[model samples]
Structures are given as C-alpha cells and as structure tokens.
Target chain A: GEEVAQTPKHLVRGEGQKAKLYCAPIKGHSYVFWYQQVLKNEFKFLISFQNENVFDETGMPKERFSAKCLPNSPCSLEIQATKLEDSAVYFCASSQYYSGNTIYFGEGSWLTVV
Target chain B: AQSVAQPEDQVNVAEGNPLTVKCTYSVSGNPYLFWYVQYPNRGLQFLLKYITGDNLVKGSYGFEAEFNKSQTSFHLKKPSALVSDSALYFCAVSLRTGNEKLTFGTGTRLTIIP
Candidate 1:
C-alpha cells in the first residue's frame, strides 16, 4: 500500500520564531493537502497542491503561514512569527485526483509553539 | 458550501457486537463522501468512499459505509466490533468536480470494549 511520509514527528518552537514542516506524498500522487488539527478538534483545511501548483489556499493565514510544493521536492509548510495558538498536529495527505477520493495521511508532525 | 456533521461525539460498543457511527453532509450538488480512521498518535487512514454506483461501500478492516442520498447520510458500520477498532473516525465531503478541499466533521471516537 502507498503511504504519505512526513518528517520530524514533533517540533517545538518558541513564539515569534519560524517553524517548517515537510511532507513527501506517495509516488504518482498528483494532489497533496495540508490540514491543521487543534487538540481534539475537527481538522481544518489549510491548503492543497496539484503537482507543485497550489490548487486552493482559502484556509491559509497569509500573514504567517506559507506552503510550497517545489517540483521534485517534498512539499513544505513554513510558519513565520509563530504564536502559542499555532500548537497543533499538522497532517499531510495525498490522493490520486482529490475529488473526494481515497486520501492517505502521514503520521503527522506535532507542532508546539510555547 | 459543503460540510459534514458527525452526530455522535462518542460511541461505546462491546466486542463482537455491531457498531455504527453516524455522519451527514450538506452540499450544493451531488456530494462525494469519504470516511477515514485515526488512531492515537498516528495519521488518518483511509477507510472508504462513496462516489457513485451501489449505495453500500465496503472498506478495509471489515468496515463498511452506506450512502443514502435521500437521507444525506453516510454512516459507517461494522458487523462485529473489536477492541482494535477503538479510534477516531471522520467523515468528509466534496461538492463539485475537482473539488479537492474537503469539509470535515468534528469526528467520532469509537470505543469497543472487550
């Protein structure tokens, strides 16, 4: 079975610092997605990419949150000037086409901004 | 806008008994529904999806979901629950073609007692 891969299962950062997370989607998967899950809450969509091109970013916080999927490289999500509220588990998911399809998720990177 | 609602926050069931987790959706057009499971400290795993064809969709780990258009629901069902089945389940939906941004529910924690 194909699987999505994420680096740094846990990250701890101080407030106003920068934090970056990486995700390598399954091979041949064209669509990738980023979501934020805050402690026992529902997941909120942050952004999505289609082969290195951003498909949707309506949920992203433009001021501090940015994500990029460079060609031939794993997708990256960077947060500048982090705040305490940014503490959550970031999930990376990938799917064949992304139309309510079978999306596989990585174990996720837990971010803690204190 | 598309959205998913999980009616129950938790469902406690005994091992070897049938279990069900209810999910409903609101979409502008014909919706595409999906179900995923998440274990503690792990990423979400794909369970099943309902696109078209038959209403009943079988998935991994002996899980199944029924797509009811009239009811606008896609409830996950298991004939015989196991303690290993204790996990969080999420329901999601997409409203239009190429709509990869999924609207997720608050999630339901299923506990199977031995």
Candidate 2:
C-alpha cells in the first residue's frame, strides 16, 4: 500500500469493554508508530516498532494497553477494560528509517468509549 | 528530552493577507522540524519539513517553513491566505539522532476570515 491504512474508522465501545484497532503500514516501511489524539487535540505517543520488534514502550500504559506488530500481519493496538478517558482517535504512522525521514500518517481510527 | 511549543491557540488572518504560525522547539541535539495541517474530520496532511542544509523548506499546498537555529523556531508562512486554508496546524520536532518519535505542539487553529 502507498499509504498507512487503519481499520474500523469508528468504534463505539462500552465502558469496561475491550477495543482493538489495526494498522497496516505502507509497503517497505520498516518503522511503525502509534499516537493517541484526545479531544483537546494533544497527541500522545503510545508506542513504536522497528520491523516487528518493540523499539519504544515507555509511553504505553503497561496495565491495560498493549500493542504488537508481527511479520505478515497488520499491527494491532488493544485497550483492555476501556474507560471514558480512553476515547480518542488512534493514529498509525510509518517511516522508512529512524532519522531524517518523513513519517506518514493514516486516516486514524476513532474510538468512542461510552 | 524533546518538546515543541505553539504559542498561539488560534490565529486569524483575512483572505489574501500573509499568514504566519509560530513554533518553537527544544531538543538535545540538532532538530528535525515539521509542520502538518488537519482539516475538519480529516487526517493530518504534511506541510513542510526542515531536516538539514537550507534554513527554508517548501512543501505541499504552497506552505513553507523557516528554520531558525538561533531562535530554535520553525515558523510556518504563506504569502497569501485563502479561505480554504483554514484548518488546525501543528508543529512537531524530533531529534536528529537516538529517538525517532516526534513531539508535537498543542496545535493552532487558523481561521481565514473573509
């Protein structure tokens, strides 16, 4: 694919339910990133992967949030026991390399926790 | 640590007038600056980026940004504002080495008043 692709454009999940989002990076892109955009429009970096390996997980919430990018599969971000605060737009981005490369973003998956 | 700041929450410009959105950054080493625009209910679109070499870099939709190392700023500019240009603009920065994650500013909502 030429652009980053995200699944389930909109997802409405009840509080305490689980929400899962998927992303497929552009072809040949080795690095994948996930960001959360809240209603305030503040973008919070969640996690990143370098060729299916966890490159950074400091920003991820260890208790309930988890993500994975395995070879030959679309990357996944899963939120367990979702809360109202968890409602946000999840954006998936990708880049060819680590430095000085332009990162392209997907259309984003909207998650609404009711 | 790396961070970006967009001083203004909102900026208004009359159609046909020049427009400027302010941005400042702080990083450990050299900075990789970028500007992105988001229309209502749409994904972010890349505007421009300042990687190295020239201080001024041009990008899509007639947008340009000037990288000022002394001031640690990358301000987005356009010669003339158009009604269609009204959108939310974000400024982001990343380190030239080590981290590949982009730290984005709060974002500036630009309105091109007719």
Candidate 3:
C-alpha cells in the first residue's frame, strides 16, 4: 500500500473489555510507530518496530498494553481491560529510516471506551 | 531527550492574509524537525520536515517552515490563508541519533476566518 492503513475506524468498547487495533505500514517502509492521541490534543508515543523487531517499548504500558509486528502480518496493538482513560485515537505511522526521514501516518483508529 | 514546544493554543488569520505558527525545540545535538496537520477526526498529515541544508523548507499544501538554529525554532508559514487550511498543527522534534520516537508539541489550532 502507498499509505499506512489502519483498521476499525471507530470502536466502542465497554470498560473492562478488550480493544484491538491493526496497522499495515506502507510498502517498503521498515519502521512502524504507534501513537495515542487523547482529548487534550497531546500525542503520546506508544511503541515502534523496526521490521518485525521491537525497536522501542519505553512508552508502552507493560501491565495491560501489548503490541506485535510479525512476518507477513499487519502490526497490532491490543489493550486488555480497557478503562475510560484508554479512549483515544490510535495512529499508525511508518518511515523508511529512523533518522532524517519523513514519517507517513494512517487515518487512525478511534477507540471509545464507555 | 528531544522536546518540541508550540507556543500558541489558537491562531486566527483572515482568509487572504499570511499566517504563522510558532515552534521551538530542544535537543542534545542537531535535531530533526517536522510539522504535521490534523483535520477534525483525521490523523496527522505530514506537512514538512527540516533535516539539513536549507533553512527554509517547503511542504504539502503550500506550507513552508523556516528553521532557525540560534532561536531553536521551526515555525510554520503560508503565503496565504484558506478556510480549508484551518486545522490542528503540531510541531515535532527528534534527535539525529539514538531515539526513534518523535516528541510532539501540545499542538496549535489554526482557524482561518472567512
């Protein structure tokens, strides 16, 4: 694909339910990143992958949030036992290089935890 | 660590007037600066980036930014404003090495009044 693709444009999940989002990076891009945008208009970095390996996970919440990018599959971000604070728009972005390169973003997945 | 700051929470300009949005950054060394725009309910769209060489960088939708090394600033600019150009703008910064994640500013809401 020419652009990063994200699945489930909008998802309404009850509190304590699980929410999963998917992302397919643009063809030829090796670096994939996930960000969470809350209502405050702040973009918080969640995680990033280089090829199929985890590049950085410092921003991830280890207790309940997990992500993976496997061979021949779209990357996934899963939130277990979602809370109201978990409601946000999850954006997937990709870049050909980690430095001095343009990173393209997807339309984003809107997750509303009620 | 790299950080970005967008000083204005909102900016308004007449449709025909020129517009500017302020941004400043701090990093240990040389930085990679970028600007992104987000329309309502949409993901962040790449506007422009400043890697090296030119102090003035042009990007999508007639947008441009001037990077000032002394001021540590990379402000977004447009020759003329359009109502359609009204959106949320974010400035981001990343180190030239080490970090793969971009640190984004709080975001500025640009409203072009008709």
TM-score, second chain, candidate 1: 0.97
Best-first order by lDDT = 3, 2, 1
Instruction: Give me the iRMSD of candidate 1, please.
Output: 1.9
Q: Which wins on DockQ, candidate 1 or candidate 3?
A: 1
lDDT of each: 0.91, 0.93, 0.94
RMSD of each: 1.3, 1.0, 1.1
Tens digits of lDDT, candidate 1, B1-114: 888999999999999999999999989889888998999999988899898899999999999999999999999999999999999999988765884677899999999999
Q: Rank the candidates by TM-score, best first.
A: 2, 3, 1
Top DockQ model: 1
The interface root-mean-square deviations, each candidate in sequence, come to: 1.9, 1.6, 1.7
**Model 3 Cα shift for residue A106 (angstroms):** 0.6
Q: Ranking under DockQ, best-scoring first?
A: 1, 3, 2
Write model 1 residue lDDT over A1-113, tens digit each, in one string: 26899988999999999999999999998999999999766798999999889999999999999999999899999999999999999999888874557777899999999
Query: What is residue A46's positional error in candidate 2, in angstroms?
Result: 0.4
What is the docking quality class of candidate 1? medium
- What fraction of native interface contacts is shared by candidate 1? 0.83
